[model samples]
Each structure stands twice: as structure tokens, then as C-alpha cells.
Target: MYCFMSTIDPGPPPQLIQLILSYLKDGQSTTEFDLRVMPLAQDGSTRRYFRVYSTNKDSFIAVDAHKTGGDPKTLSAPNQNQTFHYLACHLLERGFPVPRILQHSSDFNFYLLCDLGEVTLCSKVLENGHKNKKSTLELYQKALDLLFKLQTEALINFEHSWCYAGSVYDRNLILENELNYFLKAFVKGYLKLTVSPKSESRLQAEFQSLADEALLAPGDFFLYRDFQSKNLMLKDKMLYLIDFQGARSGPFYYDLASLLNDPYTQLLQTQREQLLSYYYKQLCNRYPKSAPDNDTFTFFFHLYSLVRTLQTLGAFAFLTRQGRKHFQSYMAPALENFHHYLARLSSSLKLDTLVELSHRLYEQNLNVKKRSP
Candidate 1:
């Protein structure tokens, strides 16, 4: 979980260090500062981060992300550094709570951002042992309120180029890329199962249907592709959003699904419903005439939840395959959520092969857990 990557070939790269120091000094000479740099815990991304400390106790997060050839399948932007910087400034102007981008390399391969501290919503939930339902509900309500703002208010006259996935969250992005990512990463790689040609056909059809249903949801709002607790930072008891480079104009229900069904938080079914109802009320209050009816919203919620579940499982499987111990910890819970959503849709969605494979994987996971000791 703690990964330290040297910023330079030898010691801390002097140029990068000086760049950060100059920014801290407000474009003045960098010679007057004493600085300390330490690696922070790594997340699911390949980007390397360091917490830079100053003698005056000022701190900033330094990110080093090398440029790479683009992959269409990735949820991250092809140029995440630039995308993050642009979006941060854009959202800040709109009164959204996001880290400030202090400075950046001309190419945007590296940057310094306001340090938001170490406590994440996910960590806070775990710290509570997920037992304090009342407190947890309050936290989620706060998150939901922030999400509403992100999806609505900040989106006024939004520019599409600020998003990594362009302006729109289209059906191809949902079905072909995200669903197929699940097929490749979780089904084939992790589960180690081969689907017959007929089953593969059926799976594709089911995924397509889900995407079509999601696309019909009633709003062209901003969708934070990863709106879960882990990407949410809490500093001074105020929620700050991060890792939003993948945001795009999409159905609002997708974000709602992402938050409520997040495996990291593992909110109980009743709790999930309460939060969903709360979000619906807020949505209606905000856009009374435009907000979809409860039945329509519920339909897209399930559809998007299923897609989000698959996407999470795929990421977990891919990360685990790459030997990332941090993501490995989430695999069991993700599988449980996978089963939970699949079961809920069994009567409505025709995904027999995927269902069977998921059940098999669940049993296999349970057996592994039993034998772990």
C-alpha cells in the first residue's frame, strides 16, 4: 500500500523540487527554503504522489505521472495531469470543493496540489467499524449534497474539454468499454473461466440493454465516474473531491449508484435505500419539473448499479492480478456486492451465464477465505 517511487534518477530531482519551491515562494527564488518529501500511500492509479513539507509547516502534494500512449479502455483520461489541473480550476471557480492546483510542469506531466490530508471517507467509515449507522448516514447525506452540487450547479455552462472522456457519457463507453473491462479483467483473468460463444453473445446483449436503459435516464448532468468514498477526502470535517479526471456529462443516476453501492463503504440495503430516497427528494426539489419519476429513477439506478458493480470488480481483479495488495483487500466485498446486484436483477435481466459464473466465483471466494487461516 505504501509505494515510494524516486522522483529523480538519483536523489530527489532538483528541477522538480525547485519548481515546487518556486511555486510555494510565489514565483520568487527557491534558494531560501528547507523542504522534506515523503511518499504517501498509493491509490488504484499508477501516478506517484509525495507529500512535500516546508520548514514553515506549509505542505503540498507533488504528483509525478509520466506521459503514456492512450488506452481507450481506461477510465482515466489519456492526459490525466492536464485534465485534473483544468477540472480543478474550473470546479473551484464554480464553488465546488476540490484541491487547488498550485503549479505544474509545462507539459503537465507533474504538478503540485493543495494537500487534503490523510483521512478519506472510506477510512473514516472503516474506523467506525461500519457500526455507527446514524453517523454513517449523516456522512453519506453530506456526500450526497456535494454530489448534487457537482452534478447540477457546477455544471452550468460546463465545457466538455475539461472532462477526460469528452463531453458525453455515451452507450459505447458504458457497454463496450466498461462492461468489456469487467469481462476481461474479472471474468477471464480473475475467475479464469471461458464463456461459450452463445454465452458471450448473451452477455453482450445484456450489457447493451443495460447501457441503453442508463442512457435514457433524464439528465445530462456531470457524472463523476468514481464517486465512491475512497475518492472523497475529508479535511477539517469538510468533504473534498479528488480523482475526478474521468468526469463527463452523463445520467445522474450513475453517480448515485456509484455512491450507494460502493463496496468500500458496504452500506446496508436499508441504508442504501434511505440515501437513494434522500437523493431523489433533493433532485426533485432542485429540478421539480425536469426530474424523472420514482419508477424511472429506480430503473436507471439498478441499471447503473449493475454497471458500476461490474466496473469495480474489474478494477479489483485487474489490480489484484498486478499484485497490488491494497486492492486485493476489496475483492471479497466487491464479489458480495456483485452477487447482491445480480440477484436483484435476476428476474428482469437475462444474464444466466454471468450469474452462474458469479455464483461460482462467490463460492470459490468463500472457500479461499475459509482456508486463509
Candidate 2:
């Protein structure tokens, strides 16, 4: 017998439920398994997931990727679902926490995954209410360790035949284009500001430099593009990576930024720096003969962190306005942090001008919100 407990009503869309039942009946006959769809928090992405369960049997998870909404070519240029499938299977073989693949219906855009359970790092931290700073830090450290291991051990060369090389949305392009998400959506779109030509020039120069710095990779590592507080699942005190469809090859620093500088959880500056140092040390310790030196690591960390921060600013606004998701409260403090960090990093007049323009727009938005009934 299987038992299901959901944070939300039902499990998934009616069609998906029917598909699962039909597939199970057609393919295998074990004891009846109960499906659970727990409402885990989601980010801007359209991907949806649920937890699965069965009595005295291994539990699992499921994903309804129906909203990905396109052919493989349209999704990301080259369309490499096979690579993701292979990588998941390979990683699972190596004792990673990815839910085991029980079944997949490519036509329906859904997959049944081994449930990794309901607890996440975010839920635990929030439950403890931030006063348990040490525990929070430790959880973050464990996550980073898992990430570092994945990059160094599991991701190297793992058969690149399915590589999406034709995709124009590589690191350089992703960084360059995604900056507009911040500039247009967050700065101009959400804040709704007008700036002098001088200010605009500065903003462009600032973003351009940051993009250039971030485009360099620390050897190609499989980037879980949306690795953050939400996509991580904690089961039996271990962290597991979920929502990995956006996985790709990029700088190792990419995941680090997504984790440490997450908008939902603004870890204090001192704590963040210490975590960075710890991450750097772990990387060096693991591949002592192969890893980059401390100075190089610091440069990449700062560079990629800025890129991620800007990308997140745009995602927050776009997700709220277009996707109908409410993430404004989470983004406010993150924007403030971005402004301060920009002030410290950018010395050019053009860059400073852009920062000032963004600031003006941000202030005005706050005023508007205050006056709105």
C-alpha cells in the first residue's frame, strides 16, 4: 500500500495523474503506490514538482514539465533532454540525491521520480528563525560541498556527445543578454525611471565590464543554473539538487553565486565571505594539484556573483509581473545589496552613473508603493 500527503490539493494536473496510472498499469505490477504532491516553494521558472510515497517501499518525487512549452529546439537551441536523462541516471549510480527515474512520458511532458522527501534547507532555516545561525551556515556548507564534489568528480567529460554547442545562449551570451533583464525589467521596467544620457552611458559601461569578467569559466562544470535555497531538498539531513532542467556547462562559480547570494536568503556579508573562503578551500583541497589558486578563485567568485545578482533582479520582476508570482518582498533587500556592491566595485563614471540612475528609480518605486491604496 502507498500513502500520500500533499501540501497542496491533489497531486498534479488531471491529465498527468491519468498518465501515471495508465503507465503503471501497462508496464509494471507492484503493490499500489500512493502519489503525493506537496507544495514546495517554486521560483520564477515554470517547472512544477511533487513528492511521492508508498508503504514499506522507497518513496520518490515527480515533475510536470508541461509548461516548458515547446519543442527541444525552441527550448534551448540544441534541445538535449537525452543528456539530462543520462546525467541523472549516472549521478544516481554514484550515490547522488537526484530522485530515481521510475517512469517518463515524453509526449505528456511528465516524469515519475523517487521522492527525496519534503524537508528543504530553507524550511529548516526558516523554522529555526535565523537565530540558529550556526546550523544555517552548516547546512549551506554541506550544500557547497555537494556542489563542489559534483563539479570536480561527477561532471568532468561525462560524454559530451549531446552537448548543445549550437546554442547561442552560452555563458557570454547568457551574461550579456541577461544583464538586460536587470536593466530593463528590474531597473527600468519595475522601477520605472528616466535617466540622463550620461547616466545611461555609465550603466552600460558598468554592466559591460561585469559581463566581460564573468564570461570566463573556471574549467567547464555542469551548472545547475537555478541552484538556490528553494530547489534543494533535505532528506535524512542530506541536501539533494532538484529542478535541474536548466543544467548546463559553465563556470563553477555560477552555482556558488546562486547558492550564497540567493535573493530569498540574504546571508550577512561577513558570513557570505567566510562561506566563499570555505568553498575555495574545499575546491583546492579536493584537487590540490589541479584547482585554481586563491586569487583566481576570488576573482571568479566576485565576477560570477555580480552576474547572478543582476540576473536575479530581472527574474524577480519578470516573475512577479508576467508570471503572476509574488516575490517583491524577497527581492527588495537583494536590490539594496546590489546597489551597495556596485558602489564598491565600479569606479568608472559611466558605471557610477548607471548605479545612480538605478538608485533614483528604486527610490521612486518605493514612494509609489507607499502611496498606492
Cα-based TM-score, every candidate = 0.89, 0.81
> lDDT for model 2, on a 0 to 1 scale?
0.67
lDDT of 1 by residue, 309-342 (tens): 8888788778777767567667667767777777
Q: Which runs in model 1 stand beyond 4 Å of their true positions?
A: 1-15, 25-30, 68-78, 363-373
The models' CA-based lDDT, in order, is 0.78, 0.67
Looking at candidate 2, the ten consecutive residues that score lowest on lDDT are: 364-373
- C-alpha lDDT of residue 213 in model 1: 67
Q: RMSD (Cα, Å) of candidate 1?
A: 4.4
Query: Largest TM-score belongs to which candidate?
Result: 1
lDDT of 1: 0.78
lDDT of 2 by residue, 1-373 (tens): 3234564545577666665565545545663765444544455656576665434345455667666534654454433344456667777877778866778766436777777767777777777666778988899899988888876666654655444432122645564556767778876777665656776776667667766666656547766777888888898888887766566567788888888888677777877888998998887777789887887776667666767777887877776677555676667767666775566556532366656665675765663222211
